[model samples]
Target: MTIIEQYGWNTVWKDKWNGKYREHEGRDLLPGRIIGDFGSKFRVITETGETWGELAGRLRHTMTDSGEYPSVGDWVLLAVQDGGEHAVIHGVLPRSSVISRKAAGNTRDEQIVASNVDTLFLVSALNDDFNVRRMERYLIMAWNSGANPVILLTKADLCQDAELKIAEMERAAPGVPVHAVSALLGDGREALLPYIRSGQTVALTGSSGCGKSTMVNWLSGRMLQLTQDVREGDSRGRHTTTHRELFVLPEGGIIVDTPGMRELQLWEDEGGLDLAFGDISSLAAGCRYSDCSHEREEGCAVLQAVAEGVLEEKRLLNYRKTQRELLYQSSKEVKQKRKSAAAAVKAGSSRSRNSGWRKEMDEY
Candidate 1:
């Protein structure tokens, strides 16, 4: 197979790159896929095999933030140097799907977890780390990612009520496939093979100790990633996978495994929320008011459903909470943009005044 094909490249991506980046036409630059991303450097796999790459000085200068840099699943054009030991990245192809979240901590910055994923495995072990509320949040982000999200309930060997947990996950995420798999026991892994067909790419992500690494190891049939046991007191595992890396699966596909995330803050648009909570949104259509808040509102279908035991009140409450958080973040981003614009204008005006003063003094 061709190098690009091995990295999950297809005709659609080639068309997109050629149509948008016409400048690369007839150039000697080769196309490469980024499989590993360090803070300042990247590991790209091209026709020449794997090579370390760094952004060209010009590309680095143009990048306004880390979000613009090459991510693990990005397809980029590279200028090979030093006989294939190193390369310089020139451009990045448009992404088909992206999994991102608000960066951990106070910053409102968006951190891209993975890009160009065809399917996202939303894993949650059935052990102590399982929480329906957290699963709901992950589902919202997964919907926003533009990739098919398949919920995986791992560590089924440990949980006594695996079927019960799977049912709950199905309820929390309607219309999404939920598979209960034990990586250690090799159960339910074969069912996931269809999603990992040739030329396809899947990403595995979940909370720490949720068996994401174990899933990677099991699927790949080797110790590709190290797995540490969760603490006895608290089911949290150490960050065994410190960096994101893409692996070419023996089963004829690519899989990007990311470090377990402790917190999954939403950084998404309204459409994602609507799709993630389609059940609630469908019920909202039956509300008496066109703009019903669904909280203590008269004739609110959502509240009515909750009251009648048709819908879980916790789901409705979480939906509203996410909506409020999205609204607040959107407003905050707008204000920050306006403030930056004002500062730019003031800086320009001051520079102009100083230049005029300098010219007058020279004339005198």
Candidate 2:
């Protein structure tokens, strides 16, 4: 058993990944989390913060093999540098949960928000930053990541009354915990610390100006980073936190904080849509046909609910919109994946043929 298994990192990622664990074990490779990442380099922290470092060539080469690139919350195989603070990251283990979004500005592929997380603290400042639809998008992505989702409404003091907002959040996120907190006021912050226990990993994601950095500073008992206030013209805050980073909570456990996302688009997780639009699903099951479209159909239970005030029509529309978006993304990703696979196979065959020709010429 590896030290990660002993320390519980292996247990968290065992079922989610299958990699060269036994080969990479021992003094060379240790388990570490990607805390701070720029474009090419990343800052990693293991149980011993002293061993923190960056990735090696092999891991970088293999990153294109799948969607297992290192993110802030990733548990990676680290090759310790014998004499310096820098260590070489050899490989990335599997992730039990991964939160992602369609990278902004018409990117074909998705961007991994965080990985290997146990809990997703979906932060939303209660001031002008709150939006039910936007919250739903994050909630869907969180649920799709396979982590337990909890809503953290920060800047609660800024809102005139939080009860109504909390109520709305509860409605928007059914069966999910909704807590309004103020990092400045120190109110309702304690309620969330239980989940930040030792050995587990919690990831925080929300728009900029949501006080994620402030929350991290408060949780860690020191200033981890800086923060800024929202503008007077708009309730939306400025981008104080720029990158996604991991931090060790002073109380226990680990936390990953991300820069605010002004534009969060859906990716390929449909289970999230099913869970988020559960009311629509439940209503649809009662539809007369097995494959009911729930639109203008006479026996559509969903339409009936919309007419009878049981379900909001807008809610159903959003569900369909998200579902269609998911389908479209999945289809597009599959086509791209097939194209990549075909290209890889063709390249490999060409390389093999070239090597054989070279061998024949050498024998001459």
Residue 350, model 2: Cα distance from true site in angstroms: 2.3
lDDT of 2 by residue, 1-364 (tens): 3433323365536544445463463554556767676767887766566455666676675784566678877777776675547778777776677888887887676788888788899888887788887888888998888999999998888889899999988877789999988877788867987788777788888887777888888888788878777786777777777788877676667788788878788877858987877778888899999888787777999999989988877778777777788889888889988998999999999999999999999999
Candidate 1 local lDDT, 1-364, one digit each (tens): 8877899877887787664654454556778899997879999998779999999887785664535777899999888899999998888887888899888999878889989999999999888999998888888888889999999999899999898889998998999999999987889988899889898999999998899999989998989999999997878888889999999888788999999988888885747898889999999999999999999889999999999999999999899999999899889888977887899899999999999999999999
lDDT of each: 0.88, 0.78
Clash counts per candidate, in order, are 0, 2
RMSD to native for every prediction? 2.2, 3.2
Question: Candidate 1 clash total?
Answer: 0
- Identify the leading candidate in terms of TM-score: 1
Superposed Cα deviation of residue 216, candidate 2 (Å): 1.7
Each prediction's TM-score against the native? Answer: 0.94, 0.90
In model 2, residue pairs whose N, Cα or C atoms come closer than 3 Å (at least 3 residues apart or on different chains), thus clashing, are 207-260, 208-260
Ten contiguous residues minimizing lDDT sum, candidate 2: 1-10
User: Model 2, which residues run further than 4 Å from truth?
Assistant: 1-22, 25-27
